[model samples]
Target: MKINFDKYHGCGNDFIIINNLSNTFPKDSENQIKKICNRRFGIGADGLILINYNDKFPFEMIYYNSDGKISTMCGNGGRCVMHYCYSNDIIDNKSEFLACDGIHHGIINDDYVKVSMSDVNGYEKYNDYLFLNTGSPHLVKFVDDVSSLDLINISRNIQKSNRFDNGVNVNLVSRKNDNLYEIRTYERGVEDETLSCGTGAVASALALNILSLINSKTVNLDTKGGLLTVDFNKSNSKYTDIHLSGKVKKVFTGILEL
Candidate 1:
């Protein structure tokens, strides 16, 4: 079989997107999906996304980790999907789409895409880390230098801990200033350090705010890939109107044979 796909990346988190409007893509072909996302053997990407036709929304986003597992909400992937829709003339500048978490609203301006994120109710504060769910579970730790730490070993230890049931994404954040922070993240599903993680960035910003480390509603996050902006409103203990914005680009398009 020959599969046509478009590649896009938000920051450095790339995805292989397929227009599955005909519902012909094999949803259960985990091995094939994994092979397609393999860096050495296939069209490499951090994840795969399928833009399927939806009855209630403009489209439905079906996301899969590079490991071929249907994973939780991916912030950067969501932005890329929206941009893909806009670039393909599937929708106008604004769109509402269905994701794993729920309905998400997105807007595209030039090469930048902004998408509304899910609200966070509260967080669990630990001695050195804060645990929260921003569409996906995350453990945020404030560090002195993001680049100096051993991320692989640290994330491995955390994932093995009993604190989380399934496993959690780890974010090592170093505050550059009150509103700017540099972050390194180990994503759970990807099971490695990604260049940029949207949900991880959101979790870090909100966690810092909860600890009074940051004083602004809008925060800038510096990732290994690039810069991302997160804006939110805090009402009591609930965080709402969250938005994640960053630049996304189309890398290339090709057909893969299986």
Candidate 2:
């Protein structure tokens, strides 16, 4: 099979986006999906996204991890797929779509894309870390220096703990100011530190808000890949209208043979 794919990235969290409107792409071949996502031997990406037709929404977003498992909602993947939809005239600048988590709305302004994320209703706090789900589960920890920590080992140990089930995306956050933070994330499905993680950023920002570390409703995050901005509204211990925004761009387009 020869598949036409376009690569896109938001703050360096890359994905291979395919227009599967005709349902031509093979959805059951996990090994083939994994091979295509291989860094050394295939078209490298953190995940793959399929833009499929939907009855209620403009389209449907089906996402897979680098391991080729149909995974939970990916914030960066959502933004990149929105970009693809807009560029392909499938949708306008602002649109709503269905993802793995739920319905999400996105607005595109030039190179910037802002997607609404799922509302978080619960939190788990440990002495040194915090846990929350922002579309995907994340473990947030504060570190003096994010650049110096060994993410793989730390995340692996935490993933093994009874506190976490299966695995969790681990985020190391450093406070730059009341409204600014620096984050480095080890994503579970990717199984390593990614340059940036949209959901992880959202988890970290909301965690900081709950800790009263952030004074502003809009939080600015600096990740190793680039910058992301998260804005939200809090009322009576509930968070809503949460939006994640960042710059997304098309990296390239190619044909992959299987």
Off by over 4 Å in 1: none
Instruction: List, residue by residue over 70-162, the lDDT tens digit for candidate 2.
Output: 889999999999999999999999999999889999999988999999998868886578989998989898778888889889888777778
The residue pairs in collision within model 1 are none
Question: Which candidate leads the pack in lDDT?
Answer: 1
C-alpha local distance difference test of each model: 0.92, 0.91
TM-score of each: 0.97, 0.97
Kindly list the per-residue Cα lDDT of model 1 for residues 126-239, writing each as its tens digit: 558999999999989988899899997899888888877678899999988767899999988778999999999999999889989888899999999999999999999999
lDDT of 1: 0.92
lDDT of 1 at 98: 96
Worst 10 residues of 1 by lDDT: 158-167
